[model samples]
Target: MNTQDRLIESTRELLWERGYIGTSPTAIQRRAKAGQGSMYHHFTGKPDLALAAIRRTAEEMRAKAEAQFSVPGTAVERVTAYLRRERDVLKGCPIGRLTQDPDVMADPVLRAPVDETLAWVRERLTSILAEGRERGELDVAMDPRATAATIFAVLQGGYVLARAADSVEPFDQAITGVLGLLTASTPATRE
Candidate 1:
């Protein structure tokens, strides 16, 4: 990778491993194998590089979600695929973890991507549930917005629960529970 790319990638990994307060310019340079001069030449400073890294991470998260959503399946099935998608459950979510960082949440510039990514996920899921309801795949009484929010909450909460217990069982159980609830909502014929 080029100097700039290396710097951005290194920052990304560092940010994931360490929050903004914990990641330092020296550490980024060391990880990237780039000297101070190269880093400054490629970017204004740490915040600039971190922003690039965070945005890249958010973009990748969106693209990954889109991959699942675009597949041929009913809304619940697509959502199930997304929930069951392989992940490093113990490591927690890259973007969701940022939400816990005081520095990241305190700075609007740093928080924008994290907030936007989460909102985007919720909105996308809402649309999918709405579509399913319209198609009679889900019960007409189901509230798409509410259901979408519930699913999103369960996912993030599951991550927290798993990490707290140092086991993937919590996350698996949460996914299974949510999937069961969703299945219960399906139209009788569809079920």
Candidate 2:
């Protein structure tokens, strides 16, 4: 691969492993097998390289979600399916992980892709829920956006729990718990 391409891939991989704070230019250069001069020749600095990586990851995540989120199915069926989709619960959501990173969260440019990607995912799921409400599959009173955000939160939180417990059991339990809430109706569960 070209130096620029190699640099971007390296950043993506590094960010996944160490996040923004831990990924250094030297490390990136080493991973890419490019020199410091070569990296600087293509990008301004770590932030610039991170932006490219974040954007690439964002697009990839969106595409993956669209595959399942936009498919034909009931809201519960789709949301549940989307949640239950195979994931590296230990590695966690790459974009979601950025939310916990001090550096990535500090820079708007660096944070933009992560925020937008997650927002879009929630919105997509919300739209699907809205559709289900129209079909009477999901209660009309349900706040689509809030419900969507809650689902995403549970997912993000599940990653934290699973990582802490060093097992997928917590992740699975968390998902099952969230599904219980999502599937709860009669508007009484809120009480």
Candidate 3:
């Protein structure tokens, strides 16, 4: 890869592990094997490089999510497929992780990609929930936006729990529990 490519890749990796505030131009230069001049030649600075990296990661994540959620299946099937999609459970969602970083949130350019990614995910899930409600697969009283946000929160919260416990069991249990709640709420299946 070129100097620019090397720098961007290194930035993404460092950001993944240490976040925006923790990553520095020196660190990225060292990781990329590029000189300070070469690094500066490609990006204005660390923030600029991180912004590019964030956008790239966001696009990758969106594509990955769409692959499963857009597939031919019922709402439960789609949700289950998305929740069960293989992930670095401990690493968590790339954008989601940034939400916790004070620096990332403070910088408008840095936070844009993270916010956009999360908003897109919630909107996509809301559409799915709406379809389910219409088809009677889900209860009519369900508010698609709120329910989607809740589902999104559960996944994000699950990552926090799993990382805190250093075990995947909590994440697995969380997903399974949601699946049960969603399926069990069908009007026909009411107790």
The global C-alpha lDDT for each of the candidates, from Candidate 1 onward, is 0.94, 0.88, 0.89
Better of 1 and 2 by lDDT: 1
lDDT (tens digit, per residue) of candidate 1 on 113-134: 9999999999999999999999
Give per-residue CA lDDT, model 3, range 1-191, as digits (tens): 99998998898888989988889999999999999999888888878899998988899999999998998888878988898999999887778898998999999989998999999999999999899889988889878898889888999999989999999989999988887878886777784
Model 2 stretches astray by more than 4 angstroms: 186-191
How many collisions per candidate?
A: 0, 0, 0
Give the local distance difference test score of model 2: 0.88
Candidate 3: minimum summed lDDT over ten consecutive residues — where?
182-191
lDDT of 1: 0.94
Highest TM-score, which number?
A: 1
Best by lDDT: 1
Sorted by lDDT, highest first, which candidate order results?
A: 1, 3, 2
Candidate 1 TM-score, true structure as reference: 0.97
Pairs clashing within candidate 2: none
Candidate 2 lDDT, 1-191, residue by residue in tens:
89999999999999999988889999999999999999989998888999999999999888888877866777887888888989989998888888889999999989888889988988888898888777877777888888888898899899999999989999999999999988884244444
Residue 178 local lDDT, model 1: 98
Give the residue spans of candidate 3 off by over 4 A.
none
